[model samples]
Target: MVSYITSTQTLSFARKPHPKEEVCGDDGAAWDDPDHTWLVISDGLGHGAGAAKATEAALSWITANYSNNLEATVRGCDKAIRHTRGVSLNIARINRSTKATDYVSVGANLGWKVQRSGIQRFAGDSGVVGSGVRNLKTTRVDLDGAGYLVLASDGLNTTSDVSALYHSTFDGDVSLAEACLERWTTGKDDSSIFVYRFT
Candidate 1:
C-alpha cells in the first residue's frame, strides 16, 4: 500500500499478488505536477514475472514521458511494452486548479466516480496494450469539489456499487482500498485498487 496527500487531494493504492505467485502482476502509481495530478493502473496479461515485467515497463514509460495528451501517453505505453506480455492500462489526469479529470483506458481495467449524488462508471475501450488499440477515446468529467475516484484492475469485481462501499466503509483512502481488495478480489489473479479523494 502507498498513499499521497496534497492540498487538493489524497490518493491511496493497494495491491496483492496471486496466492501462489511471489510477484504481483498489477501495478499502480500517482504523482503530482505543478498543475495536475496523474494516476495510473496497469494489469499485465497474466500473473508472474512476465506479467510484472510488462506492467513495470508501462509504468516506467509513463513516468518518464507523460504529458497532458492522454491518447498519446497510452500510445507511447503500448509501444514501450511491445516486446513483453500485454497489459490492461488506465490513466487519469486531474487538473489541480479546475478539478476536471481526463481519463483513458484500455482492456479490462475499471473506473468509477463516487459523489454525493451517485456513482458514475467509466468503461475501457476493448484492446490489450502492447498489442493494438481501437476506437480509443478519453473521458472527461468534473470531480466537482468533494468526491472519490476509484480505479481497479479486472481482478476485482466491477459490478459492486462503489459509492455504497465508500459510505459503508467510510474510513480514510487506505482503508477503503483495503476493504475493496478484501471484499472483491477474484483470488485467482493479481488484484489492485486505487482510491483518490479530492475536496
Candidate 2:
C-alpha cells in the first residue's frame, strides 16, 4: 500500500457553544480507498447555525458518495444540499498507483499542491455547491514524490503565502501542516486546513 498521511486544524467563530452556538462555521472529512486517498474541506455559507447545517449537510453527502469519481461526488453533494444554505467545498484525491491527483472545488475554498519545485494552485469555479452550480470541473495534476496537497476553507487569511511550507525539510511530517495552519490562521471565522502527503 502507498503511504499517505493527513493533518488538520480547526477553530470555531468566537470559540463556539461557549457562547451557546449550536455549531461552527465549517466541517471536513478524509479517507483512503484502494486506488486513491481522499481529503475534503467544507465551509458553510455563513456564520452560526445555518452555516453549520449547510456544511454538515454537504459533508454527509461527501462521506456517503466520495467513493465515486471526483466529479460525481461533487454533483452528489450539490444535489444533497440544495435545500440547505449551501456550502463551499474542496475535494482532492491522490492516485495511489501513479501519485497523480484529481480535485474539484466549488465556491470560495482554496487548495493547492505544495512541491519541492513550487506551489500549484487549484482555482475553484464560482457558485455554491447546493445552490447555483453552473458546471463542475476537475483539475488533474501529478503529485510526484514528496509532494503535498493543501486544502483550506475560506476562513484562513491568505492562501497564496505558502512559501514557508516549502522551506521546511521534506521528511513527510505532519508538523509541516500543523505549523502552516497555525501560522496562517486569522482566527476571525471558523477556519480549517487539511494536508495530504503522498509518500
Error of 1 at 155 (Å): 1.0
Per-residue error for 127 in candidate 1, Å, reads 0.5
Best by lDDT: 1
Residue 50 of model 1, lDDT score:
95
The count of backbone overlaps in candidate 1 is 0
Q: Taking the tens digit of each residue's C-alpha lDDT, what string does model 2 give over 1-199?
A: 0112333232111112112345676766776677766778888887788888888888777776666577778877788899999999888877778977888898888887777778888878888889867778988888776766788887777644775666745334545555665666666676667766565
Q: What is the lDDT of candidate 1?
A: 0.84
| Candidate 1 residue-wise lDDT, 1-199, digit = tens | 2225344436767899988999999989788888888889999999999999999888888888988889988988888789988999998898988989999999999999988888899977999999877668999989895788999999888786776754675545456788778778889899998888877
The top-ranked prediction according to TM-score is 1
Off by over 4 Å in 1: 1-9, 170-174
